[model samples]
Target chain A: MSQGNMNLTLKVWKQKNKNEKGRFETFDAKGISPDMSFLEMFDVVNEHLISSGKEPIAFDHDCREGICGMCSMYINGRPHGPKQGVTTCQLHMRSFKDGDTIVVEPWRSAAFPVIKDLAVDRSSFDRIMASGGFVSINTGNAKDANNILIPKYDADDAFNAAACIGCGACVAACKNSSAMLFVSAKVSQLALLPQGKIEKRDRVLNMVKQMDEEGFGNCTNTGACEAECPKSISLENIARMNREYLKASLT
Target chain B: MSEKSFFLSSSIGKKISMGLTGLFLISFLIVHVSVNSCIFINDGGITFNAAAHFMATNPLIRLIEIGLFAGLILHIIFALLLTLENKKARPIGYEKINGSANSNWYSRSMGILGSLLLIFLVVHLAHFWIDTKIAVFTGKADKHNTFNEMKEVFSNWYIVALYLIGVGSLLFHILHGFQSAFQTLGLNHKKYTPIIKKIGLWFSIIVCLLFASMPVAIFTELIK
Candidate 1:
């Protein structure tokens, strides 16, 4: 009640490990600052739990700055919690009113198994990348920026696609739990440039195959991934990947 | 993967299949609505019957009709398979997940909408297609007046209402399915996608309204 601070309740998902069933545990977050990032508020709750001789609530975070793609967990049914175009680390407490019960959960997908409370193993993305999500560039020197001239429009689009942080929010947000947005972003970032053009065909095919093998669902073009993506990755990337896949399969 | 298996195995392949078949069905609807709209000429059943008869007996049309049935069956099969796989992809669901927070209801409900349309199609074929095919093939009806048959069918208020409901389902189905087909085929463009969506929206509304209006018009005796 003093200034901008308020009390809130959080129903955080708790799972011991990958094989265990998860459940939500309620915690009182009192006198939380309206300006605190969502993660910071959770930090306060964890501190409280640890001091009370309780097993501290475990979640994932590396770079609290949102670019690490380490911060994840659904807050109130959204990947990054109700906020558009921001990661959980960037989501501020002011977005929710005091006395509101916020439900927090991990990204639920067969491809993403929970490692602990609020932290699922996103290594499925890594496996997908290993399939064909790269340009086989010779590693010697950093090429000059203008060595291969890319049109500004193409560069911007490639850059936008490259902005995906592998957070799995797209998969988390998708009703089918589709990995199309993530896989497509990986495919588009390379396929747009000449360096990545050599592998465009195989890249899409292999990545898509790996994606399916990982048990991720097919995209129904719901646009949920693009809508909930913290990085604002475009659905256009999925379309680009689809085009790439067709071209690969046909010839 | 081999090219054969690529189209048959990949996630993209499944979607591409869905999109392709969905577009084919949409094209079928275009022809269907156009042929049925002959009723709007207001000359009773003559013009409509001629068009219907030509469609029923034409060899090339019959060939395409087979393809149409194939496409619908394939569409439904792939839809069911994809929906099942989609459900499996998330064995553990969000306890408090918000679907409306991200995507439109229709976009997520393609399976449900498609199922409704399929149910309608069965009754529709029973009412019109089977009888006409039997009559034509039996050589008992040289001048098949399907329009009179339609008129008779629509005279029942419940049938008219059911037709409207079917058309209503078609509207939502097509609204999402139209541009979704383009996206699945990777045909999106920054310049054209917005235009494609706009066209899709109006196309769904107009096509469905026209189809719905036929039953309403017949029931009200406005066209006959």
Candidate 2:
């Protein structure tokens, strides 16, 4: 749908740091090429701001491709603009009209305090990952991958769970700011594999405990996380983690 | 934190309680609908009265009655707490929001439906339970003639309409709650979830319809 250039208005959030109050600053993004990526469009606007001797808006982004879950922005209320299954980086200007005014904001959650205009400190995810999101295997010898002989279905399910890129979109999209989808993805990715089975008990238990400590909300099964996920991760991972957690708690 | 306290305090832990209590309440609905359906025997409420009499008199069921109340109370308390916390989580809301693209209306409106059900429960208990239980124990009401009380209650068209509205709310609540309870408990399987969802829909419809029909039938004089 990329076509000719278009003029548009943009309302971007601006904050000096976590402590400072933020506000949306409007700008005229004139002659924006429809073919340009959303990030590129942002770059154009930032360059214009720089040339005009104004403080450019700060937003987090890396590896303009969608794979790196680094780029996070709430555009017009959705986690990553109007599209589904696409990160903010992959979002194209084609999704907008000639004069559309796009509203951009950072992920809002108690656990993810805002660091800048559109960047939130997502280290809570790293804390959850450290709390049993790993398996211990010796470095001395390498085992055959086929020796584990996981079923194709189980392997596929594990791969799906592992597809989560640790994006805070799930938290941002959830009405309660729940991190269940993110935590569940991590738990299920390990729980589905034999190599990860050894630490399954402590893993689910520890991760859940850490998740709670981070002040994330509970999963009410609203299914918003699964819907807004760029990777289209299934809600099944949450259920799987729940099963793993229940077993771990009982044992 | 202690394991028990953690389970009680944590979001997921409270969710588990919601599931467990919700499932317990579902069982109560099954028993209630079954007992109430006895009025369909078309024998002037003979079977219905006998079942109600037995339920009120049997010490075993009486003990279970207390447990049922506890389950209901716990369910209500946890639900209210969770809803409040969920609301607090999103203190600042979007101006141009679109939630319909993501989740079902019923899933999102559970708090409102639950509140309606809560109101319905209070009214229902006042209408039948309080009067019947007080009279039965005080030897002022015949335990075997509770069907007459049912008739008297349904005689008012407003009460019947209120009951129908309550059952309507219940239908929507259970349609989401049944599968959600199991999902929260981690009983979900790729193969079984669809089946469970289907069963949940049918179960809610049948149970709520049966409950609604009692009031309608009594008001219409179809059962008389």
Candidate 3:
């Protein structure tokens, strides 16, 4: 009832490990300051649990900023709280009402198994990246950055695509739990760049093949990923990746 | 993946099929709408009857019609499979979700729109296509009259209302399906996609409006 502070109900998913079943456990989060970040609120709850001699809820997060994409929490049906274009770490308690019941869970996808609580094993993304997300070049002397003479437009697109933070939010927000947006961002980043063109032919094919192998769903162009994406990754990258994949498959 | 499995199994490959078949069906709609638009010739159904007769008698058009049916069947089957797969992917859904915040209703309700269109198609085929084909094959060739069929079907207010409803569903379906097909096939370009989307919106409106106008015109005696 105090100004700038709210009592909230948190429904958080809890799991012992990847092999254990998960369930939602409710807890009272009282007198939370509006300025506190979402993670900070959870930290308070964890501290309370620890003080009470109960096991603290486990979650994955490193950088409290939005850059790392490690704060993968689904809040109230959205990938990262109710806000658009932000990671869970960047979400503040002010977004919710005083008595809001926030439901938090991990990314639900066949490819992303829950490790424990809100943390999931996102190694499938790493495997897909390792498949063909690299380019080979003989290193000699450091060439001037302008030696390649990249177009400004392509550079902009490459930079935009490169902004993907490897978050599984796209998979979580998607109705089909597809990872097309993430994979396409990586594909577009490489394909749009002059330096990444050497392996473009094999890169899209390999990445998509690996993506399918990981049991990810197909992109239905629902636009959920682009909307929920912390990096604002466009669905155009998926189209571009599709173009690349088709060309690779045909030729 | 094997060549067959690649097209049948992979997500992108399945989308490619949806695109190809969708485009094929779109092309069929243009032909169908054009042929039906002959009703507006206002020549006492003479021009429309002749056009319909020509379509029925032409061997090449007949062959292409077979392909059109095949394409339609494939498009429907793929749509169903994709819908099922997508449904299975999210076995447990969210307690609270906002669909319209990201995409339009038509894009999200493709399966539902498609089902409505399917119902409309079945009624349409039962009313006209089946009757005409039966007349052709049952040695009742002289009874084959598509113009009279149109006049008779539209005379009833219920049938006219149904046709308008069907056209309405078709409008929403094609509005999303048009550009979505292009996006799925990877035909998107930064420079051209906005243009494509605009064209798709107008195309859906114009085509469905034209078709819808036919039923209204006939029912109102504007064409008669």
Candidate 4:
């Protein structure tokens, strides 16, 4: 069981498009390096498929360093694999045993239909973001950083929330396919800042209305989304969003 | 949006209503468990019947009982609607999923546990509640005392088994529901949330253990 010669079985979901049915296709991933990233392993497998005159599996990736949030593969029944606080691009093959049969699939949500083998059309997130994930400002140069006197703790929390890369991992991991963690992180990042205060009411109201209309499920506070988030987004953002929504709705 | 549609159409609003109603039902459990504990006084239904009779005859208690029913009804309604909506959110099922890796089983199965509790409630209301509360409401004078009813109901091993299963389901249900209700209300904080979760664990254990022990004690003739 040397670190280098790790061979494994990969059962990947293969879907032609949103309208077509999907099925799991197994591939023999051979001569995989332990140090290689999960996506790199996929690259090796896709290389094998292409060499055999088979269709290359379509997936999404950018900034292979983890910040872009594009590489989403529900590996071994966990979004972004077994590692905590790491995206698929950051996950290493050393986490799995040499003889393991890994299961990989696209994000399963009605709001995020599978566009290809492992890529989903997460444009629903874009629509929700468009509804209100912005702060209004005058047409001028950006304000100086030190001008706004935000508490250090508030800034840190906002930063933590702002770390969200709009990945569909939260929705993928949720039993109900709820986007609360994603939306809450988006909402909290803005709400904690003074700039977000101007349109706080309408922002939450419009964003939530759009969220509901997009067919995402309800949050039951299971904390799965937070657990699966690569950025380590806290469930407190969800509670904060709930409070903000309540305040906006009532007033 | 109008007040009615906001609660009906919005997901967060439905969750908020569920949380509020769930908290109300939780408080009622305190009253219920406390009254049920009176049977432990073991004076052969004297003190137990007195508390039961007072609960039945008091006007304020009757009004609170109405509110309790309303709370229970709302809790059930929202739970059902949300369950259906959540099911629809994932139109296509996952080929393979590991739910336990990310969340506790009870938290994910609230709908199933709640349905079990609802079934238990019907059997329970028929056994004791119809005997006392419904009798008082319908002006029927003769019925068994609350203590004797407990003794009789628990005398049958089958009925006692059902009660334990009901209490067991409630333990897991409350274990998740208590802290969940608070979080849904946006009351989560780093400092306070840990305390809330600890309290919720202890409360669920204490309440469910007390309830579960009742049926076992009666069946074993430990309290009679």
Residue runs of model 1 more than 4 Å from their true location after superposition: A138-145, B1-5
Q: Write the per-residue lDDT of candidate 4 for residues A1-251, one digit (tens) a residue.
A: 35467999999999998899888889899999999999998899889889999998899999999999898899988999899999999999999998899999899898998999999999999999988846787778977869779889999999999999998999999999999999999889989998888887778888888889899999998989988899999999999999999998888
Write the residue-wise lDDT of candidate 3 on A205-244 in tens digits: 7788888888887777878889999999998899999888
Pairs with steric clashes in candidate 3: none
Selected candidate, larger TM-score, 1 vs 3: 1
lDDT of 4 at A191: 93
TM-score of candidate 3 restricted to chain B? 0.95
Off by over 4 Å in 2: A1-3, B1-5, B141-144
How does candidate 2 fare on TM-score?
A: 0.93
Q: After superposition, how far is residue A4 of candidate 3 from its true place, in Å?
A: 1.6
* TM-score per candidate, chains pooled: 0.96, 0.93, 0.93, 0.96
lDDT (tens digit, per residue) of candidate 2 on A49-147: 999999888888988888889999988888988899999999999999998988888888888888988888999999989887567776867877677
Q: What is residue A229's positional error in candidate 3, in angstroms?
A: 1.0
How far residue A6's Cα lies from its native spot in candidate 1, in Å, is: 1.3
Task: DockQ winner between 1 and 4, please give it.
Answer: 1
Residue A181: error of model 2 in Å?
Answer: 0.9
Q: Could you give candidate 2's per-residue lDDT for residues B1-224 as a string of tens digits? A: 22322567767778999999999999999989999999999798889888887887788999999999999999989987887776666555554556787888888788889899999999999988887688778976454477888898999999999999899999999899999988888887878999999999999999998999999999999988
Q: Candidate 3's residue-wise lDDT over B134-194, tens digit each?
A: 8778877565889888989999999999988899999998898899889988877879989
Interface RMSD, per-candidate values to 1 decimal:
2.0, 2.7, 3.0, 2.6
